[model samples]
Target chain A: MTTEMTHTTASEPVTDRPIMTPAVDVYENQDELLIVADLPGVTSDSLSIDLEDDRLTIYGRRKALCSEDTPVLMGGGRAFDFRRVFTVPEAVDAEKITASLEAGVLQLHLPRHERTKPRRISIRTAG
Target chain B: MWMTWNDFDRHFAAIDTLRRELERSVGGTRQSRRLGRWPEATLVDEGERFVFAVDVPGLTQDDLTIDVHNSTLTVAARRVVNPPEGYATHRSERTGFEWKKSFTLPAKIDGERTAANLEEGVLTISLSKLPEAQPRRISIA
Candidate 1:
């Protein structure tokens, strides 16, 4: 599995807004894998998630509350978009995958395919 | 001894499992260069009122405490991490901490009329300037 760099050089950097990698935590269990990401100021309309070809990508855009054109009394926080990518080794149940956004936090649940889950075999006693 | 197709596949699977474990343990954590400036804040002057905004994602209104005194506004919050049940953490990059920050206003503020709102993980506080501080046109005869 590999992590993708948010600030890629392939594309020219947007002068007013740059790209940022949102912080995330990955959790796994026998039933499913849980991915939690923090995307501040991201709205439902601006957030996007995609999974294809064993790659999972999370992208979001946040509108700046204070624009650069306006007069500034103090400046600290800069405006930026968020993006992150991850690779999945095992086949996931795409139909069962669920995602939700609350308080700007994104939570994704990827259930393992039934075929990929471990199963116990029963043995019969010899007569 | 000769290798069979099944054996070859099993060997590769074991090696793949080992590689996956190593990657999980690597567990990257970025932002060393931008340390000490978390939940960045900005203050902007909009005519008669000033707007102060902060980026505190994944935070609820109850998780924060705000105090305003004259031209100084203080925002404090203590974040707690609570992992869900029946889950094993493979990588944890999100951190929790007690953070407090203050911003200064350019003009005297009418504290009584100041208002703060939290939406989509951003906290925006509007401080209206006092009547004395508002710009007034002066005429000379």
Candidate 2:
């Protein structure tokens, strides 16, 4: 089992009215770290993932589906924008990160650095 | 080098309470739907058909089951959590949940004529009103 993940903070452009921090899940394996986020109502075209100075930021805007005339029988949070940031650890390979968005879920793959990966030890035969 | 939403609040606390309230209400962490324990949903009543939509992110059409018994419509689904192989979890804010929401419509609906589609994580279930339930103009001599 891997050790407890180190929690780091990230930064983003400040905006008024508060930003919705989309729920996120992060997992790490031998080769890479994966982050999955649920961003309902956000489209592929509107979503963006950026990594700067070891800070990874996920941004997206949700277009309102309900119209004015439509009567909303029940009201939910109704947030228009989503934002979340994470500070990348030293083990992460910053150069080779990939992301994809499907069905309102965003998945990010951050590979580990070649030097940081674990290596198997070879046994030598006694002479 | 690292910053979380908590740190951001330390920098500025404007609208902090509002943001927290919104998260609590929208996250569906508690206060399940009025009918029962289900995801947040909205219903729009059009003249011809009524549209019911719910926020079920990370769910496909196959994950849901919709059924209409009498005048009541029931929606049920389960979200599964699958972590990658040899993975060690860091943050786990999004968890799997089983949701079921049902509503009693004012008018009877044609069960066979219903249509449902899942797009961008939103599940839309549309039902057309029965012919007799639809409004019609009666002309008198």
DockQ, candidate 2, comes to 0.33
lDDT per residue, candidate 1, B90-138, as tens digits? Answer: 9777777576755555557898999998887778898899987676666
How would you encode candidate 1's per-residue C-alpha lDDT over A1-127 as one tens digit per residue?
1133423323555575767777788998878899998887899899988888787888898886766677654544456778777887656888788999988788999999999886778999999
Candidate 1 ranges with C-alpha deviation above 4 Å: A1-16, A76-78, A120-127, B1-37, B137-141
lDDT winner among the candidates?
A: 1
The residue pairs in collision within model 2 are A9-B2, A9-B3, A9-B4, A10-B3
| TM-score per candidate | 0.77, 0.72
> Listing every candidate in turn, what is its Cα RMSD in Å to the true structure after a full C-alpha superposition?
19.1, 12.8
**Model 2: per-residue lDDT, tens digit, B1-141?**
345788566523423432343345455533232112236566666656777777778898789999986556888988987876789998777767886656666557889889998988878888888887665666777
Put down candidate 2 lDDT per residue, A1-127, tens digits, no spaces: 0111112223333654335567788998889999998887788888888888887888888765556676444444344577777889988988899988888788999999999998988999999
- In candidate 1, which residue pairs get closer than 3 Å at backbone N, Cα or C atoms, i.e. clash? none
| The 10-residue segment with the lowest total lDDT in model 2 chain A | A1-10
